[model samples]
Target: MNCPKCRAGKLQGITLKTKQGAALGLDQCSICGGVWFDRGELEGYLSGAVEVLDSPSLHPKLAVELDHCEASCPRCAKPLAKSKAPQSPRIQGDACAACGGLWLDAGETGGIALAEKVNAAFDSWLAGLKPKA
Candidate 1:
């Protein structure tokens, strides 16, 4: 199993909790900003059924869903396919249609859970800007 992000070593298997507080295997990369997911893991993350660990980078309060498209399954090496969640479209995620594996980057894990905030921030920033008549 190659590290999906760095493409160096096999992913070190580490179970991580999703936003919803369920346990899931989320490979840790430590070196680069990346993690690996097996099949159906994305759905769990998106649903807030799983949560990333609590760390300076990982937000414990916020259920973070991982997002990364340019990653391949440690086993199959097929380019991970991405799809938008029906609920949160602003976020992009990758999955292996063949195997159902998933991959998410560092910040991506937090974006989906807080998507509304992202939109709100954008809207607020736009409101502050002068509009051209």
Candidate 2:
């Protein structure tokens, strides 16, 4: 499969196991180091059930700005809907409504994990604050 974002690299399948021991196979782009999640695969990462493998070279390219790029789903061949990753407005990803698939650019999966951690910590801190009398 070809990468939905770069459109140049072929996607290679990698097996990932969730915390609950459920195995999932996802596609990773060789050139851009992006990842493609099918259906609910991203949910596992959001819920802290999956561990993302380290891709040190996954960095945003200064030349390829995706803020306004219209990407197509590699699976369905349909135009993907652009949206910000949860808790990280700076990191944008494309979702395929037809297939419920998600495309995360280079370094985005790690960014999402970090953002969720920060948000959770902030929420906990806020909840612990006492009401001002």
Candidate 3:
């Protein structure tokens, strides 16, 4: 599959292993460093604590800027719907409404995973401060 963002970038299939030894496979853009995750794959990786953003192979410097318009799903060949994450609106995400797949720009996985961790920690701390009944 060709990269939706880079247009010319080839989508390379790679397997990412979580800390728990769970393996998830996805496609990544060799040019723009974006990732294409099938439905539930991103959630599974994050839940299992997969550290991937720091990988140099996944993030390569590109000579051209990424283009978002007209991006389509490599799986179903349908247009991708762009939106910001509800938990972290600053980070943009793309999804295939047809296939339920998700697309994230380079470094977005780290941002999302970090946010999840921080939110979990905050919730735990807040719960600990609640008055005993």
Top candidate when judged by TM-score against the true structure: 3
State the lDDT of candidate 3 residue by residue for 3-47, as single tens digits. 887687898988878888877788888777788988878667666
How far residue 84's Cα lies from its native spot in candidate 2, in Å, is 3.8
Arrange candidates by TM-score, highest first: which order?
3, 2, 1
Instruction: Show where candidate 1 strays beyond 4 Å.
Output: 17-22, 48-50, 53-71, 85-88, 116-133
TM-score of each: 0.56, 0.74, 0.77
Model 2, 13-120: lDDT tens digits are 888777788777778887777788887676665654567655536335532564346789999899998876553366678878798787887777787778767888
Please count the clashing residue pairs in each candidate, in the order shown. 13, 0, 0
C-alpha-based local distance difference test score of model 3: 0.74
Residue 44, candidate 2: alpha-carbon lDDT = 65
Between candidates 1 and 3, the one scoring higher on lDDT is 3
lDDT of 1 by residue, 1-133 (tens): 6666556545566776655566776675664445565665556655554444332254533224233226676668777767753445675656567776666655666666576457769999998897767
Q: Weakest 10 consecutive residues, lDDT, candidate 2?
A: 58-67
lDDT of model 2 at position 85: 51
Query: In candidate 2, which residue ranges exceed 4 Å CA deviation?
Result: 56-63, 66-68, 85-91, 123-133
* Better by TM-score, candidate 3 or 2: 3
Error of 1 at 12 (Å): 2.2
